[model samples]
Target: MWLKRFGGGCSREKLRSILETPDGELIIVGGKSHGNNQYKCTFEFYDDAWILKVDADNGAKIWEKTYGGRNYEHFEDIVKNPNGGYYAIGTACNKKNPPWGGDYCAKNKSALWMKFDDSGNSLGKKHFTNGPNQTGFSITNTSSGGTAWVGESKKLVGSKWQYKAIFYKLTGTKVNYSKVVDLGGWNATSIELTKDGGFIIAAGKNVFKTDSDMKIPALEK
Candidate 1:
């Protein structure tokens, strides 16, 4: 095998999510690879959510900020909200708790939702436990204020394995979580608000709508 090494300059792979601002600035969030992956099983390794302002002209980095705990944080997606600010969905594990604490770890994984202001400062961060593995897929703004996140919840029921499409909505400064919507065996992957003020959530093998009530229809491949 041919081995390649960097003399002195070295950079690791990064997972990135991007959002376009109203003024056309691009906002990127992802984790910076901490040198080599060798330190993971030993030292604390983190893939933080970092913001980068890139020049749309030459695709050069203008500004960037890294946000996360001393754990694994990877942003799956980013969205620009109607009220400004940006929302990100991802998973983090082995982290601290409360005002951003907790190793909400499970099977070596944890579900995470992190929000940031226009300036890249973290507005709020929350973690959810779903047995071992869980991840946040998408986020959308709610007309009623606050935001909504959809993802899959993997857990167990007796001796059987169960997967659920879960929804969580947060409101106010306290960010009180609303009751989760169980899509029964469905896995929610993407969420959007329909024109009628209803929510259209695409769950595995199914698409659903909820407007004070819930109804699901099979989505054909």
Candidate 2:
């Protein structure tokens, strides 16, 4: 048995997802507290998303990088891109913090998707903002050679606000389709492409199945 840890310099870090490479390496993604890498003294780091690559044998570090915006931004899921590079999904906030009061910076947040190269260099990015609310919680590659992402979005209906499970797909920077599923939950944590050219998602206590276009049947909806 073996155990390892990282970010000893930071005050704290929270891991979100981990993926294994075909050649036996590991890709780990998470959020870390903001601070100087040389010293973990204060909270200036501002909560940013970070990725780390390590050897599968002894857990030795290969490379590490961080992605951040004006405020809170973090990765919730990651998936491999069929064309090349990798896709990462998370929540990005553009709001600035109050100088006197400690605000959560939850408002004005939107779903963020980014593409990175093999060495963790960013290539492109996209944001999905529906009614000014959506978070990127899960990502996967579809059968049509495009990337798909799912998450929870706060949508306003006729009178009241409702929580919606959002799904979207795109190739490169062009979005081909989008769908919203009422999964009776807060968010979808995982998703996978099925053999029948559909999608199977895990959300709350229910498993939702959808067609190629991400439309669920009446029985499943």
Candidate 3:
């Protein structure tokens, strides 16, 4: 057995998700600092979402890709598309706060989804904003050749702040369904494609079963 390492000249780096392609290649996605090696104790750091394609046998790096703006972009989850490509979900933050107001810029985070070709080239990208801040946690390929993802968001309700889970379905660049469901203020951690052409969302102590249309028809504790 052997160990392999990959990174830039940054002080911090992390790998969030890993997937094996149909041909046995490995794809890893995460975030890494784009700044210099100068270590800082504060939270002020510039980073970019990083994607790497490696040979499964020898762990050799085939290609690398980074996505970001002048701010930070952290990728949390990635899935291999059926069409010989990939889909990644995460959060993208810039210098400007969200237009919804109410301290959205306090964190400057928004839901981000990006599509990449087999060669690690970006095909398209989308930013989703349901409230002040939203961050995608998981993404899965749908049975209809589309994609579905779930995340957490903070919204204002009755002069108070409330947390909710947001779900979205996309087909090629079109949004099929976008729903915000309140799950008792618990963060929706992960989502999976069920065998019955549906989805199961795991949040805190509850599991939500949604139909093909992503409607919560049953909730399990």
Candidate 4:
């Protein structure tokens, strides 16, 4: 067993996720604050989302990068794609002009997705925001060179604010299937592609399965 440290020089960095690449390297994703941002928070950086590739054997930094110009952006989940790129989901507070092509945000927070090549280059980005406090927590690879993410969406359900679990399937940055589950779970924290052509998701206190289209009975609540 070995332990290694990253981020230095008076900067505050917090790691959010890590994945092993096909080539046995490590891809670490998190947020970095160059020091002192809006909140005047001292313990951590909440300015930009950070990603880096490092040697798995000895933890030598190969490449490192930080995205999100100024607003608050933090990656909550990440997954390695079959086509050699990486997909990440952000629980972001990017209200205005985001890099992913979204213009309006009903609230201070929104859900985000971004793709990065093996060399850590931005490939594409997408955001899902229907109401207030939208957040995506997990991203997983499904069949057919596609990816999926699970998150929370706050919307009005019959004059009452409800927290819905949102599932989105993407085919190369294009949303092909989406489902808003109003099961009162608050947030979907994890997701996996099942072997039987289905999906399993874990939200606040709910676990359910859905077909490839994210439709049907939701198997079990």
- Predicted structure with the largest TM-score when compared to the true one: 3
Considering only N, C-alpha and C atoms within 3 Å, which residue pairs clash in candidate 1? 95-102, 96-101, 96-102, 97-101, 97-102
The runs of at least 3 residues in candidate 4 whose Cα sits more than 4 Å from the true structure, single-residue gaps closed, are 8-12, 36-45, 97-106, 155-162, 218-221
Name the regions of candidate 1 deviating beyond 4 angstroms.
Answer: 1-16, 35-45, 94-108, 156-162, 173-186, 212-221
How many clashing pairs does model 4 include? Answer: 0
Model 3 Cα lDDT, one tens digit per residue, 1-221: 55688876444678889999888989999887765234422132356788999999899999898988544687899998887899999888744523422432445568889999998899999888877778899999898999999988886668877788888888876889887777789878788889998998887787888888887745322
Candidate topping lDDT: 3
Model 1 Cα lDDT, one tens digit per residue, 3-81 = 2221122244354566678778677765564432345322224455556666665566666777666556667678776
Q: TM-score, each model?
A: 0.71, 0.83, 0.84, 0.81
What's the residue-level lDDT of 28 in candidate 4?
91
lDDT of 4 by residue, 46-100 (tens): 4577899999988999999988754566688889877788999976674664332
**Candidate 1 at residue 44, lDDT?**
27
Error of 4 at 193 (Å): 1.1
lDDT of 1 at 2: 33
lDDT of each: 0.62, 0.74, 0.80, 0.76
lDDT of 2 by residue, 1-221 (tens): 45778874655577789898656788888777664334443453356777888898899999988888534667888887766567899887655452222444544667889888877788987778865578888888878887777888875567776787777777766777776666664567778888987889877777788887766666343
Q: What's the residue-level lDDT of 194 in candidate 4? A: 90
- Best-first order by lDDT: 3, 4, 2, 1
